[model samples]
Target chain A: MVKLINADEAVSLFKSGQSLMIGGFLSCGTPDMVIDRLVQTALKDFTLIANDTTTPDCNRGKLISAHKIKKAIVTHIGTNPETIAQMNNGEIEVDLVPQGTLAERIRAGGAGLGGILTPVGVGTDAAQNKEIIRIDDRDYLLEKPLKADIALIYATYGDAYGNLAYDGTTRNFNVLMPLAADTTIVEVENFSDTPLDPNQVIVPGIFVDYMIVRNKHG
Target chain B: MDKDKIQEIIARRVAREFHDRDVITLGIGLPTKSIQYIPHDIQVNILSENGIFGVGSYQTEENYDPHIINAGGVGVTIKAGGCFIDSFMSFSMIRGGHIDVTVLGALQVDQEGNLANWCIPGKFTPGMGGAMDLVVGTKKLIIAMEHTAKGAPKILKKCTLPLTVAQKVNMIVTEKGVFEVTPQGLCLREISPYSSLEDIKQTTEADFITDLK
Candidate 1:
């Protein structure tokens, strides 16, 4: 059974050298509290699957600027100049997936689907010796699904049963990230005691393993 | 016009569209330039997909943190009382409708207002980035683009390519004019004196008409 905890206790679950599927494309839809909690832990050498690493003072970006992460699978590194600096300096390993491909790969990971083929990143430096699958006699690049040891997710609202409701704009990565990891942690605002309406539940309760109620500290 | 000149035309259009106190997200190219020209007193809070909301082009050198980026993933700085967040948290803000307006770049805008930002035929394509989500999720969408690309009118009667977001554009600002998509078709609200409806039609693929006075 999943345990219910506050932001601090829930985030403590992360450890050094863990593969983390942190949800969000760019900066939207991150589990802020869990990220905040990770800060307190000083966990290092973590592998992150996300869209961007961000800058030092960027709310969630500090993790990268502070050197808390080891590797990342992402689309672009435009915002985190330091991250780019690290990459250019060969201090960081970056696997730049096309944005849509990255999201589809995450979804495939969660759905337990094998890698799919896409035209994204094709004919570019990004398309290295990855498998090229042929569909309808046309060549498409094979992209692999990405799985992680842990998943950190954010939501606008949640019920005690772990149903999630994400607000717009921030809904980028939350929908698929929960299932790609062994353990899924949700940080949410306004936890409700009543069961969430089935019609509105974006992330089902079954995929969630832990719930962290967002508080003032978050 | 050259790319820079075209962008300037788009810049002025976007700067004029700023709503006071609005929380805004600007996409790549001209959409991002709105920040550089806005009146300083507008008090619009800016959000970037890469994760900074309180920012602009004129950030101090000391404040050049790389993680702080705008919707285009370009590095930026934050204003006072601003907080840096994980990219995931930033997406949550967008998914949750926390942003009031989003300015997207358009490769092709169909008559029904669907957008195609990725995969241009015979031309190179870029990542869809966050456009698919922004078009579907943001409360309002404003597209900024050249009136045509390589002399081909991208304002289409219907999307001929894969769609990034379905029927989400509310307003469009191009080098040639400003248009609002309505039930009838593209409504030309503002047109450059040098251009006309027929001129737009020569390049536009959609059925468009001058708005009723």
Candidate 2:
């Protein structure tokens, strides 16, 4: 059973130097309230896993701007000047993974797979130091799975049991992170006692450990 | 050729390559513009790497939802029966080779059909997004760009900048002409009506087989 908790309690799980997988594309589909709470905390040295660190004022970018994130595994960071500045100055470590491979690695983590074989970064700098395996005479890079201490996700609807339903592009990374983390927390805009339609539910309640209702007035 | 006209011609030519029911991914910049020129008769599902499948063209500002956007962060509508997935599933369609064609913008395409478009050295680059995956996973890859950058030939003997993916381009569509990548080298397939073979020779630095059929 997924327990409903307030934002502060949800973010309290975060600690210094813990790896976190946050769900968002830019700012959309992000657990902003949780992020705001995380910002309020003095926690630092976070290793962030996300699609992109958005603009300075945006969700994940706020963390980057605050210098809370020590390392980031992301696909893109061009939109945020702060992240670029930090990366260039050696203030933060940014490992820019190919977007597809990043997704598959997360998926592998969630699915309990050891790793995936992909040809995406072959012959490129992105494949540096990675093992390449040949199956049937074709080379594929072995990308290890990615997991985290906690995963933060956003949803349009969540039931008392934490069955989650996402809306639009907001569903991007939100749906995958929950499966790959030790503790999965979802921030939902709407919550109901009744379960979401089985077909409508993107992430089942079994994967979710905690649910936070998004602050309505904020 | 007029600049806009050249873009239109190149877009229209690329649009012709799209067939009905093809799962296609369009890169940012000029490739995204190609959607407007896509023929009305053929309905291709435009996949956005940001987790959108069967994406439609730009939506009116009045009806736009800020959250509903394409891979480029522009508001867009979805085609009938189209659905949304996460970036993981979106790239699964890409890396799993479920996509048919990917039209990308290129900075330089070498004689061996290699592409270099993501960045220019000494300039801050955002890093590669889904370009590397698309180049390898899609069945066909097309490079859509202007023939020259500030009058410097982009079709080169070898890419001076970093390579996005090696020897993966199947076709190159430029304002001046259309080229097909082959084992021998780039083959000139179609010359733009506005430009001539001499114009191509004057601007193109790479050796291309003049096999105009």
What do the candidate models score in CA lDDT, each in turn?
0.72, 0.87
Q: Using TM-score, give the best candidate's number.
A: 2
C-alpha lDDT (0 to 100) for residue A190 of candidate 1: 64
**What lDDT tens digits, residue by residue, belong to model 2 across residues B1-213?**
578887887888888889989999998878877888778888889899887898976889687786688877778888898998888788888988899999999889899988887667657668787888888899999999999989999999999887889888999998888999898878999998878999999999999998997
TM-score for candidate 2, please give it. 0.96
Candidate 1: what lDDT? 0.72
lDDT of 2: 0.87
**Candidate 1's residue-wise lDDT over B1-213, tens digit each?**
578988888888878788798888887777888777888777888876655666656445776543334555455556786655434456557755787888888778887888877655334333355655455447788999888888998889887776766667888888888899888777888887657767776888788778733
Q: In candidate 1, what are the lDDT values of residues A1-218, reduced to their tens digit?
A: 33588777776778899998876645555677777657767688888887666555664476777678778787666666777666666666866665656777887898879987765444334467988777898557798898999888777788878788764445566667888999998877668888777887878888888887777435
TM-score of the A chain in candidate 1: the value is 0.92
- State candidate 2's DockQ: 0.74
